[model samples]
Target chain A: MSDDNQHQETFEDFKNSFNYGSRSDLNFKFLKNLSGEDASHFFQELLWKIGDSFNDGDFTRVVDHVNETQAKAYAGVGRFTYDDSPFTPLRAPLSQLRLGLMTSSGHFVAGDDPKPFGVENMSQQEAETRIDDFLKVEPQLSVIPMDTSIEKLRVRHGGYDVRASMADPNVNFPISRLAELQAEGRIGELASDAYSFVGAASQLRLLNHTGPEWVRMFQEKKIDALLLVPV
Target chain B: MEAGGIPTVVIGVHAFRDRLAAMRLPRTVITPHPMGRTLGAPKDDETQKQVILAALDLLETAQKPGKIIDLPGRYRL
Candidate 1:
């Protein structure tokens, strides 16, 4: 079969795997006409557009057309809301304050014996399948020292695709860029280590407990400001 | 982090703008990119650095909480 035919078959198989309801608007015939790379990009963009609708609660318009199980899941996926917005002004000049980097991109230094968040030895496929199970696991933070090279990092996350991050850890964890900024004196000093966690985990635990604990860790490290990059 | 007295600024994608708004994070810079590639396409150093710089700038300039700045750029790769 031709490459285009194979891609079309794959796309059809993927579509059949999910219950997209009676949403005829999802017909992606145009995708089959594009090159593989362009098709992949368009598909990702489509998913994000759908995700935005879900987040905005606009997906309800098609909820009735979807199966009961899918409809229930959609209804349950409400965005979390907090009662207050917190703010802390920078304590010192940017040229003098120590800075830290953190990400929800599920990254860890390569060759680490025990991976952070109990994701050691977990494959991307397994991670995707165990999303809910992973969410139940206690949030674990991995420390990546500032000196570690980007090539020495690996990503494993159940929440979203990790291909982009695996190719360039800076896509979500911009440690190298932060270091460059430090070198240019744009920031005072980069913290000795950066942090990462699987953002797919329980937000309640994070907000009430793990998050505070992480903040305390940052405090102990004397980090003046934090830059969070969430995947 | 703001409540803990260590200021924080989030560099996130625009797709999650609603969720981010709901979370009431201290400070944020929204980039028009996909979920996985939050900064930009892989290996796109220029765009990635720009996003980082934007977040850093927000850290220094943001005077209040819940400030979500839309970064003016798209994924270049």
Candidate 2:
């Protein structure tokens, strides 16, 4: 095949292999808009980074490359930071402490109707299509009971691909694994309710208001330690 | 939540180490997994359970804030 044909074939393979949602379409369009040479370079770099991960069993390089590209694309956007790190020593032994689970994977119980960021009454497709608008609103939290079946869980995040999490909520929200640990006596107990929220929201709101509110709820439950899974 | 007296540990992907560091969380366990599968690959109950245990270990042992531990493993899928 000619070089042009080869690049086109590779791009086609990439499109087929990447099974993300609407945001992926935006990424595809962006790639399509690039000049032929620029597109080839982009794909080459991406493949190289992916290969590096497989070779070294580390993904930091791939992740850094993507982050750098995104940083360049949104150069002026500010990133969130904190000046202080708060620490509360575990007061009880691991086997005796009541554990709480939380995830930013945007998971909720089926039929719970969690309107993340106040985007109410929209299907998953609608929420994804308007994800940019959703990112601007205050973060919302969903409570998933500890014993909720995996079949009753659903995810609605727009930050990254949610398909893996949709297929298996334990990928990001490992409530079942925590319950198993509790059963094995690795922990004293599991909180009756776990918390979740869409992480791709206004961090200011989460840091100042919503996060504290969630903390208060955990406090009310007398949770001794928490396990947070961020997707 | 650590500020509220409820100790917390975060299980995250290694790709976001800088972002996680900037957040200044109390304890963190960074795993060599993809973005969506922070704990492990889908349906891999063994790896998932191991990741959870690692986080729980950090909760019990980490003495200072901003403690980030890298769980040694590659993505299986």
The top-ranked prediction according to TM-score is 2
Worst 10 residues of 1 chain A by lDDT: A21-30
Model 1 ranges with Cα > 4 A deviation: A1-77, A113-120
Model 2 CA lDDT for position A214: 85
Highest-DockQ candidate: 2
Q: How far out, in Å, is residue A219 in model 2?
A: 0.9
Error at A52, model 2, angstroms: 14
| TM-scores of the models, in the order given | 0.76, 0.78
Candidate 1 at A34: error in angstroms? 22
Instruction: Give per-residue CA lDDT, model 2, range A97-136, as digits (tens).
Output: 7988888888988889687545565666666566777678
C-alpha displacement of A165 in model 1, angstroms? Answer: 0.8
CA error at residue A211 for candidate 1, angstroms: 1.0
The docking category that best describes candidate 2 is medium
DockQ of each candidate relative to the true complex? 0.48, 0.55
User: Which residue pairs come into collision in candidate 1?
Assistant: none
Q: lDDT by residue for model 1 over A1-231, one digit each (tens)?
A: 568755654554444343222221112222323455654555565566578787886654332222222212222214688767878999777889899999988898888623534556878766766777878866678889988998899888777768888888889998877888899999999999999888888878887889889988898999999999887
